[model samples]
Target: MKYLYYSLALFILSSFITPNDDADYEKEIKEWHKNRIESLKKENGWLNLAGLFWLEEGRNSFGADIENKIIFPTGKSGNFLGEFILSNGEVFIEAKKGAEIYHENEKVEKLKIFPSEKPILLKHHTLRWFVIKRGNKYAIRLRDLDSPFLKEFHGIETFQIDKKWKLKAKFEPTVGKKIAILDVTGQTSQQDSPGKLIFTVAGKEYALDALAEGDELFIIFGDITNKKETYGAGRFVYAAKPDADGFTSLDFNKAYNPPCAFTPYATCPLPPKQNLLPIAISAGEKNYGNH
Candidate 1:
């Protein structure tokens, strides 16, 4: 009897000492999330994104002119600072003599209005904007050099850290490129997709097809947690480029809400059909209150 009691005690002690992989993964995810929150709150982060103005075809005059030019916001001021000509996949903004352009909050005097390099900056007072190319379209992304949103910005909310949602997914390439249709606002467009991610949880297997966006594989997925614990429409997750063996980490703990969650001006992308999951993924960011 004495020997049996000692054996039982030893078994309990060993169980307590055993490493819990789930716990470790959750800790790592929490740290990554904390760092992300801090980065977004930094100067010049997405929290400062003020406006995304789409340029029309031909020359669109911008500045203080109400009739001829699109008027600048209150903090930004200038006269008929010339026009932003959008044509043939290129944008050229001709600035007047006294007009100043800024990157972030600092003046960029060396940046010419129509540089051969393209995507130059224009600034006045605490207002700064940059010309960028999205496919064949040209648009100006405006940011207030001293926007109040940045000044009063707070961190985003997240679900209680849980390790159960950190999943190891298997990548399965499609026979060829697949077409994915995206519905945003009232518009719908088709996008080319490489493949889908297959993973299992609670004895059930699931798959989510992803679209390429810049360097990351963008995935929009919905689950049972939607509208209750998660965002109603869906959420987004970006996986890094796969390794040589075509393997990548799909950590749902890093899932994040779209920009529309914070600001009404944002036109966010909705989740695709194949990406929706039937399981509850109880992890990642929660609903941001700003909306």
Candidate 2:
């Protein structure tokens, strides 16, 4: 009995000295999350996004005038003299005499300004906007539009900061390239995804196919936490490039809400059909405000 008790004590001592893998992983996840929140709150981050305007197919006049086809802010009063024509997937703005049009900090002649096949950069006060292409369509993205970082903007809320939600995911290649359809308010487009992320929990395995967004793999998932710990419809996650062994890190601590979570001006994409997870992901940002 004495020997058995000594062995039991030794086992407990060794367990404490070595520590548990889960505890170490949780620490890393928390640190990553802290860094991520700080980055998003930076001046140029997505939190600063404020508007999205869709251009009409033809000439659209913009000014402070209530009767103008497209209206500008009150600060831009009396500056608009002509209209911008959208024809053949291009925008042409004819500026009036003494009017200024700047692209990338340089003033250019505006008589027959054929701006890039992209959105023109415009600034008034601290606000900035640029034209962006979404599936052959053009729209303007505004930053610092009516920015009241304290009044209009509220910080992100999170779950109880549990570690079980931090998961290890595995990559599973598809037989061939899979095209995933994204349905959003302003755009519906198909994106090609290389494969799916498979992970196991509670003795069960689940998979979520990843869609490419610029250099990152974007994922939208719905879980039991929906409407309880996270947004009702779903939440988003961005994964970096896989490592040399085809392994990727999926830190749920970095999960965030779609742009729609903050404002009505955004047209965020919904999760594709196969990307939904069957388990509850009780990590990351929670629902914001009433919406």
Sliding window of 10 residues with minimal summed lDDT for model 1: 107-116
For all predicted structures, in order, the TM-scores are 0.79, 0.79
RMSD to native for every prediction? 3.9, 3.7
lDDT of all the models against the reference?
0.70, 0.68
lDDT tens digits, residue span 114-232, model 1: 33554555666766677654444555677665666667757777877766666677777765676655544445567778778777889888888888889888888988888876777
Candidate 2 residue pairs in clash (backbone atoms < 3 Å): 119-131
Candidate 2 ranges beyond 4 A from true positions = 1-31, 41-43, 75-82, 96-101, 108-120, 149-151, 213-216, 240-246
Misplaced by over 4 Å in model 1 are 1-23, 102-118, 134-136, 181-190, 212-216, 240-248, 265-267
In angstroms, how far off is 280's CA in candidate 2? Answer: 1.9
